[model samples]
Structure formats: C-alpha cells, structure tokens
Target: MKSKSNKSICKICGSDFARSGMTRHIKSCLGKHFKAKTKGKAKRLYYLHIYAFYNPDYFLHILISENARLEDLDNFLRDIWVECCGHMSSFMRPGQHQEIGMKNKINEIFEPGLTFSYMYDFGDTTELSIKNIEIFNGAIKSKKKIQLISRNSPPLVACDECNKNMAEIICAQCQWDGTGWLCKKCAKNHECGDEMFLPVVNSPRTGVCGYTGD
Candidate 1:
C-alpha cells in the first residue's frame, strides 16, 4: 500500500496535493490563501491530520473546536470513513495500550505534534493514524463541533486481470495477498466467483466486512 501514489483536493483552493505534501499545503493555505472569521469571541480549534495507518492514502483533514469531545471526532470519522456494522472503536497513543475516553475534551489532550492511533471494528480492524497538527482560530466560521475540511481523492488501482482500467471491485478472499483488484468487466470473470466480491470504495475499509461505501 505504501508504494501506491495518493493525492487529495484542498477544498479551500480546489487544488490537488500529494499525500506527502498535504500537511505543508494546508498549513500555508489556511493562513495565506484562506481566511476564517475567528473573531466574535476568542476561540481556538485544533487542526487534526488523520490518515489510514499503514495505508496512508486514505486520509482526512479536520478542524475540531476545543470544546469538542473525543466522541465528536469519533462520530465524524465513523460517518465519513470507517463505520461498518457499529463495531467498537477507540483512540490511543500510538505505542500504548490504554484507550482515550470519548468524553475527553479536545483541549485537555490535544497538543501540537501529538500523534495517536484509532482503531475501528476490532474484528476487521481498520486502523487510522491521527495527529494534532496545529491550533487555529474561528474554525472557518463553523458551528459544528468538528469540521471535515478535506479528504483524499479516491485512489485509482489498475485491474489485476487486464492490467488496465480503474478497479471498481475486489475479491475479498484474494485481497489478503493484495492481488484482487478488478475492473467492472474483469470482476464478472473473476475465478473466485461473484459471491466473494466487494465493491472498491473510497474509504480504507474497502473490501472489509460488509463495507460498500459511505
């Protein structure tokens, strides 16, 4: 998965950036190119950069208000990226065993350079890497507890069968070896049969459990 190239669109500018460069891109854009009405009352919000753990291509850029709780972030993630079957999920320090409570206030735990791990659906295990990148004001004039500022563009994979065309389906049984991407046409002729197939969705949870897409 690391070898795959990935990119995301910056909603503010409508320009695309490579995964490796998104952090720098957003940091600069948020201040120079885009401005938020952070006036009114004094407010601080945490800018979190989140992405799939080992599979970094799938990612999200969020601006969470200081008053927001961990639960707010968890719900936002589930709504957009990984909530399949309502399985339990948690956030923890990257190398730790303890889980952070959903009720914990963002202002209490968030700090620049802090990176954490998020696991969704323990059984299928779609893990994500979350990091508090920066603290900013106003939150783009949003009232919501958390805002999804940006997300990675849908990754395109070539069909393993014909070696051309974007893959739209995966053979779940064959995904373990990372060799089951299939285009619409090739998916019909997969030797594993149609029952083992799963649609290739945008989220990192694609092909896992009963996930189809959001």
Candidate 2:
C-alpha cells in the first residue's frame, strides 16, 4: 500500500495517524492493547521521537529503555535507518563533549524536554534530530532494549521526470542538482545512466553514499 506522507503507523493498533496526533493516539492504543505491565525490574521507558533534521518527512517514534546504552540506540538506528557502510555514529547535545555522550547510558543524558542530534556516516552524513518525548515510570513487556512504537510509513515520492509514477530509483549525482527521481519506466532514459542510480528506499539516506536500504 502507498504510505501516508505526513502520517505514521501505530504498531499497537495498525492504524495511521497524522504526525500531530500520533503521540496521543499511540498512548491510547497502547493502553487498550497492552494491559500487561512489566513483571521483573522497576524499569523506566523513555519515549523518543527521531526525525530527519532538514526534511521531517521521515520519522520514528520509539520507546527505549533507560538502562540501554547510547550505543544501543545508535545500533538500532543503524539497523533500521542509516547503516550502509558501517561508518561511525554518535549522539550529541550542543556544547557537550562528544565522548561524554558516546560513553553514557541513554538515561544519563536524557531529561524532560531534552533534545539532541545524531550523526551517522561522517563522510556523507545523515543527520537526525532526536527529542525525548516523555518518560514512563513502568516498562512495556519487551526483551528488546529499543521498541519501535510507531514509524512514518514511507513517504510517497513520484517520479520527477514524469510526475506520474512512483519513483523507483534516485540518481546520486543528479539528486544534488534536484532532478533525479525516476520510475522504472523513466529510469530507462535517465541521463546520468544506471551506474549512478540508487534504489529509492524508505530512508533519509536515500541517494546518499552507498545506502540502498537498511
């Protein structure tokens, strides 16, 4: 199915919601679907929202453990969004030393209303803005350190050449020039040639350094 450009899918209820309504809708859906509470430790769950810094088209709402390491979030982001060539990544808050954030647990750095930035692939960097939405005193019943609560379904992109069909590939060299999107039909005639074409994936890293998909 074609995804909603400005909406996301709620994992709990399988419903689509606009960006502004998703947070509240997810909380309500979770309440109805998951009555079971954490059984073992008194853990805290950190609600987080991650989005493209420049183009808010791609985004995700996640619940991460307070005890989870910064590296865990980094790895999760890599697995789902930005890991193409195994490049170095780090989370940073303005004016803070990078080492401190890299070495700390997520809870150590997170606070109410805290906002931060993440960088993946130092060369052709895919930067993301991360905000701590809220903190829950109890944890969800999950073994994973990071749980994907909701995510923006892939935004619909039409071929730039024809503006009719969905884009199937992006020409990296042409993307910077602002006219590279192509469908399978138009890809046959792309001036940049097939060698420069990258598969159009549901990621901000599309058309970037060696990144086809997660």
Q: Tens digit of lDDT per residue, candidate 1, span 81-200?
A: 887788999989768979999999999888999898999988889999999998877644556887677898888788877877888888998877767888899888778998899888
Off by over 4 Å in 1: 1-6, 33-37
The total of clashing pairs for model 2 equals 0
TM-score of 2: 0.89
Query: What is every candidate's alpha-carbon RMSD to the true fold?
Result: 2.0, 2.8
- In the range 89-123, model 2's lDDT, one tens digit per residue, is 88888555464466588888888687788988878
What is the lDDT for 128 in model 2? 92
TM-scores, all candidates, are 0.92, 0.89
- Span of 10 residues, lowest total lDDT, candidate 2: 30-39
lDDT of 1 at 79: 88
